[model samples]
Target chain A: MNEKAYFSEQIRLYEQNIYGLALSILKNEHDAADVMQDAILKAYSSLHTLRDRRKFKSWILSIVHNTAIEHLRRQKPTIDIDEQYDLAAPEPTVDPETRHTVRAAIEQLSLAHREVIVLYYYENYSTGQIAEILDLPPATVRQQLFRARKALSKHLNKEDFDR
Target chain B: MTTPSDRDIRRQLEAEGRPAVPDFVHQMTEATLAALPEKLPVQRRPSPFKRISAAAACAALLMLGVLPNVSPAYAQAAGRIPLLGSLIRVLTIRNYTYDDGSHLLEADIPHVEDDDNAEAAALINADIDALTNAAVSRFYHELELSGQGYGSIHIDYETVTATDRWFTLQLRVTETAASSTTYLKYYHIDRQTGRHVGFGDLFAPDSFAALEAAIRAEMQAQMDADPQIDYYIEDEQPDGAPTTLSADQPFFFTENGDLVIVYDKYTIAPGSMGNPAFTIPKSVYEPLLK
Candidate 1:
């Protein structure tokens, strides 16, 4: 009914998903935390203009994405540590010697791929939900998942078996 | 052997995200909730014709010896009539000059009172207005003729601080995309109260771009009365920040010393009356309120 109760309820409903969205974009805990703060702050500031209740998740996610992109722009370093390792054949993940390598490979993928992976696997969102959250077509989301899987499989040194 | 299923891949990757969100988010939410205003400021700028008329009025007043000698009380009362006249003319897209002091052009959009979806409807209504304005005029006409589309007009309102030119109106619209039921938004500024109130539409629309043009023509004339500044749009980012023709951050400087910036993005749509009209934040162009 009141502004406080209104937004607080919204936060309660999608806060975790929002955090998860930010984490997918930022990767690291500290940056993701900062992005979360920025997203929530912006949403709070602009909440008065919002009219639709059903689109809150998508709306909030859009805010989170914009804030994250702006933050990333200011930082100027597009960091994807795990993505680089994915390019190279990684070590066996069952062993600790290769677990770090596997992690590195995951990070080495492009931010776009990493985003799909994070949303699909890490956040437990279906491809459809991920597509809506990211404002992408469902087919595109499916394709990204396909590519992300191929890339991750290659890095895990399981391309032969996995593919 | 078959490859790992998409579901399997999804499960494996889901493990990588943060195990938990920090405790501060709750604290931040509390702080944010506490910080939110009881009433949200309407962000719509005044209509373009209102801005032009305001400018035209100033130019006319300065040319006549009448502006300097005019008393504050006489000017205030006189100022409103021209604005009301100009706005009615501009919004109707017909030339009209009315001397009647009692007439006020009011656009009403009735919406649902449900709080859950009000904000989204408000945002969409505004967005649709802005998007239509930015789109080419022919594109706008196509939308209009199809009996299904949205449109918007850019309005800039301004006047000297000495002259009291405040534009006020109550706007209402519905957003069906957000809910099954309609919502009503009361977009009005109490010139006496200085209070700006806005909410969502009351009913769902088969087509949301119902009232874009009529409201635009009406609001445009209201804004054209104030002559504070003029602007043109360089670029617009839907779902992102607007890029303005202004060269500086916030308000930019020109060879002449006037505060100028592209402040509004209007949407055109069908109204409750089934007429096309515009909707946006009145505050964006509230610079003219000065």
Candidate 2:
């Protein structure tokens, strides 16, 4: 197969994963779509940088991750601490009627926590791999996971979930 | 209600993450692919035909018994045709990837592919190794001392110019922390000399003062011609840019053999000016060149 065709097929297979990652990081549909396009072009241009084609999945995702971060960085000089939220105290109570599904609970997470969770739980990257992807320390990834779990427990921690 | 298990969370995460992604390849890549140059310089793949041709050439040579028992006459003739002897190329020797939450590094260091020109290739390769290793070790040293810092360096290279007369390999490094900056180191071989020539080797040492003046004049001319263009020329800015051009200043030659002196960002101007380059027309530097 020609290089172009092969590349197109690969993108076809991974487009959903690309969109998912961008959406989780950007948390906005329009912006996520823009990033998906940017990431695709970026991956296509820099394909030579990847020595092994087998590593394409993680490599492309990392490019998407970097592109998304760069987009966010351009929008604002620095991420505001206020927006990151206090993981220590999540919420007082959960309304039974508005019972948070795991998906909905994840949506409530700050960008910092949301990205790691999605990459880990959804994509199954290891803490070490996640560190490389997100440019974080392995230890920090572990700590974030710990805090993220505590924070999610506020919403997922309920009494009648057996059903 | 009870807490969900990791499996349950994974299922829900899947539900949230997977949306039907449209056929974005055509929509996105067509324009990008069209806009890109026919070939990216960093692409190292040799075509199937080239490989076949190389094999055929080897077989032909062996049929003539040139390979099994090469004659001094053939050796001298083959030396003129570089392909018949050996082809030099650039190869990615190693990729150094590391991250510690605060400090990160991703370097794809390349070396001149070994060939009969091992002596010259070795020199270029050694320089590349030293530059790359120093950057990586510097990151680690900072990580060890402070326990926290935010810096990243990405090393990529391209063969900018390759011909029978001259060969240039550019090692482009981008370092990022609070902000990003780019640095370029160029290696060149004047095929006529068969020896790698640096900026100093190209020009007579005593002539640098004149060359520095020439470069400063170009910087000033650019600024004068366009208000948008700026540089940190002496007395133009408070701190003043370097007044003297060092012998080892980073540079590369044009196809026409013009000399372009390069300065990394924040060296000759503010970061906004980017990497400043001044090309000395061959006519201007001809007398100074060796």
Candidate 3:
């Protein structure tokens, strides 16, 4: 296949996933859109050099992550300790305050830890998959997951499970 | 009584409603496609002979014998042109102008091409020295390879391109012992405009023997040039060996002035070198540079 067709096909396959990744990181829809636009511009501009087509998904995802980080660093958006509850999560049983508390607790964790949580929890990535996506060792991914779990546990410990 | 297990957190987060993604995403692919230069106007209804010519053009691209000259432009556009490998820490591009004017970009390398010629040259020199050190160290370790008749010996740097907004650096290395050459180029991409303003090339000759001879000659020259400078300071033998080390080997200088040499097959002295001329003390460096 010609280069343009090949790249456009790749873009179609991964567009939603890339968008989802950006959304998880940026939180706000508008910011996520901006990140997505920038990432796609970059991806399309550099599409010719993908040596291993098999790894394209992961490669695109990495670009998105780095682009999001760059945008976030520039903006330095303020995170409300309470806004963490917007995990966009469907835990309706949990009270708003409690959910917010748990999210806030998750937010308090370092960026490294937060990335693992976002990947595993929101993106539904397996440990091995997450390892490749983040360019981290498997052991490191597992450790971050373990720490994220521990942090969540501490927050839930202060409130009842049913409430 | 639902427990918030790892799987549960994942499920809950995934279950939440995702906001509508912006419209620009779907448009991005189209925009990029639109930006492409129009193909040369060829006859639409070519005869069978013309079709054969088209097929021949495609075939030529795949011919293994013609590998080197096949338009590096594709690789650069693909962003797969290994921006960096061993020996290169960074690549920064300078000023960039878009023919289509879709995006114009410019980048600033802290150590290169800022109105200060002396400062930029010194930074570039240090970068070269660090790369040299890496090449020498790699030669040092490749020598330790067991039962191998093969060895490599060439190392050098090349300038890919330097402009006001775009700079390209390619770190080229060849290992004769391994019968392979690695090419890595780092692009300091400009944020404001999408251009690379500067570039670097870190290359080694194809033969281990040649690489070694060249390194020894370079080191000897450096040593003889400044006999007054101490070549064998404390910890010169980073691994506690009595062998001496040189500072020109792309040594890593932390913000704190810690000197660490990152050569092929070797990484030495994490936090020992005194202040480097490139760096101000942390108290001063942080406030000014950061």
Best by DockQ: 1
Give the top-scoring candidate (lDDT): 2
Q: For residues B32-139, what per-residue lDDT tens digits would candidate 3 score against the true structure?
A: 555543331111111111122333334423331333321212112212222223212232321111111221112111123322233444545444434333333333
For candidate 3, what TM-score does chain B get against the true chain B? 0.24
DockQ of 1: 0.15
DockQ of 3: 0.13
Ranking by TM-score: 2, 1, 3
- List, residue by residue over B29-95, the lDDT tens digit for candidate 2: 4554444344432232211101123333344334334222212131122112122125666666666
Q: Is model 3 an incorrect, acceptable, medium or high docking prediction? A: incorrect
Q: iRMS of every model, one decimal?
A: 13.3, 13.8, 16.1
Can you give the TM-score per candidate against the true fold?
A: 0.41, 0.46, 0.40
Q: What TM-score should be assigned to candidate 2?
A: 0.46
Q: In candidate 2, which residue pairs clash?
A: A136-B101, A137-B100, A137-B101, A158-B1, A159-B1, A160-B1, A161-B1, A161-B2
Error of 2 at B195 (Å): 13
Q: Which docking band does candidate 1 fall into?
A: incorrect
Candidate 3 residue lDDT tens string, A57-129: 8667776776776677557657543253223332233344544444444555555666677677655677656
What does candidate 1 score on TM?
Answer: 0.41
